[model samples]
Target chain A: MPSETPAAYDPSAYPPFAVTVDLVVLTIRAGALRVLLVRRATEPFAGRLALPGGFVQIDEDLLPAARRELAEETGVRLGRAHLEQLGTYGHPDRDPRMRVVSVAYLALVPDLAQPVAGTDAAEADLVPVAAVEPLDRLAFDHGRILADGLERARAKLTYTTLATTFCPPEFTVTELRAVYEAVWGTTVDPRNFHRKVLASDGFVEPTGETTTRGGGRPAQLHRQGSAEQLHPPLTR
Target chain B: MPSETPAAYDPSAYPPFAVTVDLVVLTIRAGALRVLLVRRATEPFAGRLALPGGFVQIDEDLLPAARRELAEETGVRLGRAHLEQLGTYGHPDRDPRMRVVSVAYLALVPDLAQPVAGTDAAEADLVPVAAVEPLDRLAFDHGRILADGLERARAKLTYTTLATTFCPPEFTVTELRAVYEAVWGTTVDPRNFHRKVLASDGFVEPTGETTTRGGGRPAQLHRQGSAEQLHPPLTR
Candidate 1:
């Protein structure tokens, strides 16, 4: 058959461009806020600390790319977590060699699962948020991106049902309280927190069950409600 | 200079990558929100509609890059607007030719100045936010970026000292009400708004002045205060 209309230009016409997806995974662990990070094994700041990231394939949406990176690096499913597009970082100089643009995602996993480090990662670990002080040395411009994502996570917990994403399908109110306390970095009165949660419509509905996750009195188990947007949004 | 340590095969050996900052300039016009858009005059997607943007110069920060882009394309200082980093977007195929990445900023400017089209921009216009639906034809993944930016802007106004950024330095309470109405696309009780503004500490301070910009009873003038973060965030 005759060749179809000539393609404008072959893919080889331009310089080799690398696309990647980075994940700023955050969670509450042991009464402190933590972020998921990995040590780089390959060149380009090998051995330096960095966020979980990897190359994006040719056929996937940006979120899918992030989920793929997460799965590849940590052996986690794209589901069982709260994920959203944080933003993108594409500075020509961001990468030293060729041009690389990264689509970053902000992920909140309720209770972290054991990380199954990918072959590409030198080592993966959960880092306490407080320990990342001198973030200036973080790989890429991710230091800034991480900060933005963290702020968004903190603020979102106050107004949306997003915080619930950080917990299992059915969780105790006390567990939910911890998520708030960890994110806000402030101690909330348990009595007040309890009242507010029940007052906010569609925030949490009783699952007709109770949980003894802790050794104290069994707490009521609740699930996320139908409300998508929180009305009269919760504030500090 | 003298020969230093041979930094053996550093990945940093690659050429300095290029970074760009794109701005999604938004304003409320004609009772509906509008966004500033420019048509590219050169390939990749020449003559296609896209947000106004440009490469970030070596000496500039992200905010400055956004402002410079605005001034270069529209011939207006976007300094007074409420400018915030929306996030970064760097999908490899986002730019067909090279590995180009963009840092996107969301800017809200009070309807103060008219835009003058630029040389690179074949056509410039303010398109209503509702009219420009993200139907897979917005040049790149810019439609997704715009949606995220708009949501951030709308949510921010409810809890920060941001809505005032969309109003002149000396605006009336009623004028302030309009800013919220336009941004949130909802009606607010004027009396409730006035009372709430007075209640929020450092929200606004009386200038002992009044404005005569409109033909009506003199409206009181107030200046923005120095509240970095709102403790009890405002809710609609």
Candidate 2:
């Protein structure tokens, strides 16, 4: 309830603004990167698709609110997924009804089943990034939020072991490389990619198991290593 | 104003929370990296050194609010400084009075004159990072914000040309190295540092000027170049 003015500095002088949390939930599905979007059921872009989000509860922390909203909207528990603060959007005119500030969260979850519409959403679905041209058309500056989240995810793959977050517990090197390819939207040289990934110590560790799912030569499986960062980042 | 509960979905049902912006202003001064902090004059950790900051205006954007608070508290203009959204803090109990969420900003400015305490502050001064051992002692989660900002500044220097933000418009390689040393708190090999910085394309460009301020050897002046990212980042 802190006032906007500094001279008087009253805690309750300024009108309160609604604070909300938005989740940009992303996953790699069918060899493409997709994001979860919900259809707004109310006015103020009523029919437009928007990111899954809601107001933060008065008793909750920022991350907890984000987790609660994500779960309520998509029925996805954030157990092992990677979630981080993206940014806050507080343009006075962003929300039509009144002043509302939204703290966005970027979540990278392993491939999951399709999402279902929750309480506040009319519909929910996973939309491929390539299908959504001119992302600015989404509800209430959400296009900008989505773009920022995607950029953060793509950039994080270069230096962090976040790419592993998109894979199963034990995954082949090809599977890990596919994550980079899908997120970056480009083909990578398999040989060079393998060499570079392996050269970066603690990026991935062998599980001593091989996958012959395609009836070809068995590919060794690996799991995420302890190191969080790539010493020499795999630049795009 | 969005409601806190999804079941009712009333925009006006929930009370509004106060939103503020806190700034972590950093600069390289006197061969050390220091942050600008203000001693509070009001209750709730009064007399404790906290980052200079204030409430966001109803009509202003987040960045503008940060700039205004920073200038008012420290008498430093953000005209040439590098500013970016750091993160948002929204623990319901962060403020004892009410629910307050703070959007934090990180700013890197060139060395400047000493600061004068402005409104809402009893004292304003630049304290070296080494001096603030347990940064968490600052007023109301500011210490954690400062730690996060410092880690971000260090990590950014590895992959971005952000080191230039700490230097003046025209500076020598030695002066640039000093920035790295001060922020990272480690001495870098001059020869290797020079070679690496120069090899990184568009990192810095020669200004065809020389300065012998220290009276050792004339050092050529350089300016920040167009590239924003450093490929094969210089790791610690």
Which candidate leads in DockQ? 2
After superposition on all C-alphas, the RMSD of every candidate to the true structure, in Å, is 5.9, 2.9
User: Which candidate has the highest TM-score of all?
Assistant: 2
TM-score of each: 0.80, 0.92
DockQ for all candidate structures vs. native:
0.15, 0.45
Write model 1 residue lDDT over A102-180, tens digit each, in one string: 7778998866657545646267778888888578788877798789889888867867877777777888778888888
Query: Residues B84-188, candidate 2, lDDT per residue (tens digit)?
Result: 999999998887767889999998888876655666636777889889858778888999999999988888888899889888889999999999888877889
Span of 10 residues, lowest total lDDT, candidate 1 chain B:
B1-10
Q: What local lDDT does model 2 show for residue B131?
A: 93
The model with the greatest lDDT is: 2
For model 1 chain A, the run of ten residues with the poorest summed lDDT:
A1-10
Backbone collision count in every prediction? 12, 1
Weakest lDDT window of 10 consecutive positions for candidate 2 chain A: A1-10
Question: iRMSD (Å) of candidate 2?
Answer: 3.8
Q: After aligning candidate 2 to the native by TM-score, how far in Å is the CA of B159 from where it should be?
A: 1.3
True contacts kept of 1: 0.08
